[model samples]
Target: MGTDVRDETRNATSLLESNLMAAAKDLRNETRKATRTLERNLMAAVNEIYKRITALEQVLGWYRAGNYNLYKVFTERANYTESLENCEKYGARLAVDGIIDATILRDLIDNLINSTDYGTYVGLDDRAKEGTFMWLSGKPLIAGEVRWNSGEPNDDLGGGQDCAYIRAEAWNFDDHYCETKLNYICEKMA
Candidate 1:
């Protein structure tokens, strides 16, 4: 009877150990599932925040300098023609060439576009006739009013760089091929 009792006790201990092991495994699996769900929720929240920020930025027009509102489209890149069209959608025009406007644009570009190795298209271009740069407002860019990059107005490249752009590091207008796709800035009257 004593042996029988000892055998029964050992069997009960073994069963308890098995039950504990199973419970531990189940807890571990549940913890893992909860962790995965939390990560997914965090990602969704982050994406929503990013979308909201972008929408807010569009409404704010990027920057307000003097009497004009400047907007730089750094995400979407397009050629000279396409850029003009895009600006039209926003009820604005490609940035024009004026002393104050150019200065404001240069400062904005220096802060934003300078870090990237990309260029931003400006409104000034000599597309209709070479060596005669004109702004989108039908006014020619007068010499000495605004500075251009050193050795610029070099329309000697392929197809002659007719479109003007503000380079990243230089922050000065330089002629570029009209067909070359690049980021662009838009201007609206405040």
Candidate 2:
């Protein structure tokens, strides 16, 4: 009887030890799972907050549209060179996206064509070689892809219309002289 009791006690202790070890492993795994879930939830919340902040920025007169960064329009008149310099000073450059050359600005602002009588400067020029236009981003402006105003980019009697200017009334590039002062658009990455 004593031997049987001793055997029973030993068996019970071994079983209890095994059960405790299994329980501990299970608890560790659960803790790890919970931690991962909490991390994911925190990341999702941070992303949502960022989206809300971006919306608020738009409400505060910042312009943004498809595939473009936040845009800042300067109504104050400035020449083409000055416009470039001013945009650079503010850590930006002239609006020179491939889409902008077409008709993206129209969607960016309602009635943008009729917004004001003043025209805007873009980061396009053929100063490198006459009749060879290119954007500041180093992308070539294929002539076939764009619509030029009546007799535009003519260099104005061989005076050389190197820079590109977009007249407000006309959505297309009616164009203007580089030396001419006008309102301009600046773009910074989002």
Candidate 3:
């Protein structure tokens, strides 16, 4: 009888140890799953933050490239004489005979055209001689390079007007009275 009792007790102890070990294995598996879930969530949040930062960086780059810098309408409203005075005040001059790239010319056209009823005088004119439209900066106008409207520089009505203006459509040139009170576009050294 004593031997049988000892055997039964040992069997019961062994069974309990096995059950405990199984429970410990289950706990470890659950902990690993939870850790993996937390890591995935953290990585997703980091990626979202990185995308937002990249978009903001692009916007800052555009602002720094002078895309937003433009001439105001008030500066363009003065006539040829007042426009020159205003340009001097603002440390700039009218768009003269200079090597204008596409970007600057596009900006000038978008900003200066159609701000008023009258055409605005640019820094180009043929006041010195006929067929000699020169920039106020003392540069000669090159032939076959002018973007003039059909039948332009007519010196219409017998040569009273000599100043140049970007037409309302911003596609061609027109000569107007230099003393006419119209807006003007000014260019400064960047």
Candidate 4:
């Protein structure tokens, strides 16, 4: 009778051991599956980031090659007259109407204004016709896109203000006497 009881106890212990081993195996399998899934997601994210970086590099390459038009901002303060002289020295001109796009405009606003306190001149002038502004490059001004400061181009002001300068605070334009001293942005043919 004691031998029978011992045999039964051994059988129960063996069954419990088998069940524990099976459970451990199942847990290991699940862990491996989860690890593989995480690896796949990480690889995909890295690949996507690499693709974006490549595309941006291509664009920068084009800019370096002068295949795309770009705006170069100057922080040195100089009047429109001096700005034009400096542009000639660098083989560039103040940005004209055709060059005004959202990208360039935003860049100019952010870079020029955030970096300096002096106003920078753009290539806008109403020298040709009163109330009809035209860029120095002879393109008509697009009405809504231009940045003009309050009470600007009021040519009636005794000071002969004819040129426009970009103010840093709000990217607004203010007409000054063409001879006023201010920094300028030059655009070269790209």
Off by over 4 Å in 3: 1-76, 97-103, 111-118
- Give lDDT tens digits, candidate 1, residues 1-190: 9999999999999999999999999999999999999999999999999667657765764655544465555548899999999989878888773223666655666555665678888788998888898888898878875568898878865457899888767677789988899988787655
Superposition-based RMSD of candidate 3 using all C-alpha atoms, in angstroms: 13.4
Model 1 misplaced regions, further than 4 Å: 1-61, 97-102, 157-159
Ranking by lDDT: 1, 2, 4, 3
Query: Per-residue lDDT tens digits of candidate 4, residues 72-112?
Result: 66767787878888878867788763236766676656644
After superposition on all C-alphas, the RMSD of every candidate to the true structure, in Å, is: 15.6, 3.5, 13.4, 12.2
User: What TM-score, to 2 decimals, does candidate 1 have?
Assistant: 0.62
- For model 3, residues 25-78, the per-residue Cα lDDT tens digits are 999999999999999999999989866765664454211113333243343366
**Cα-based lDDT for every prediction:** 0.77, 0.75, 0.67, 0.72
Candidate 1 pairs with clashing backbones: none
Candidate 4 overall lDDT versus native: 0.72
Give all TM-scores, in the order shown: 0.62, 0.76, 0.55, 0.58
Off by over 4 Å in 4: 1-67, 97-99
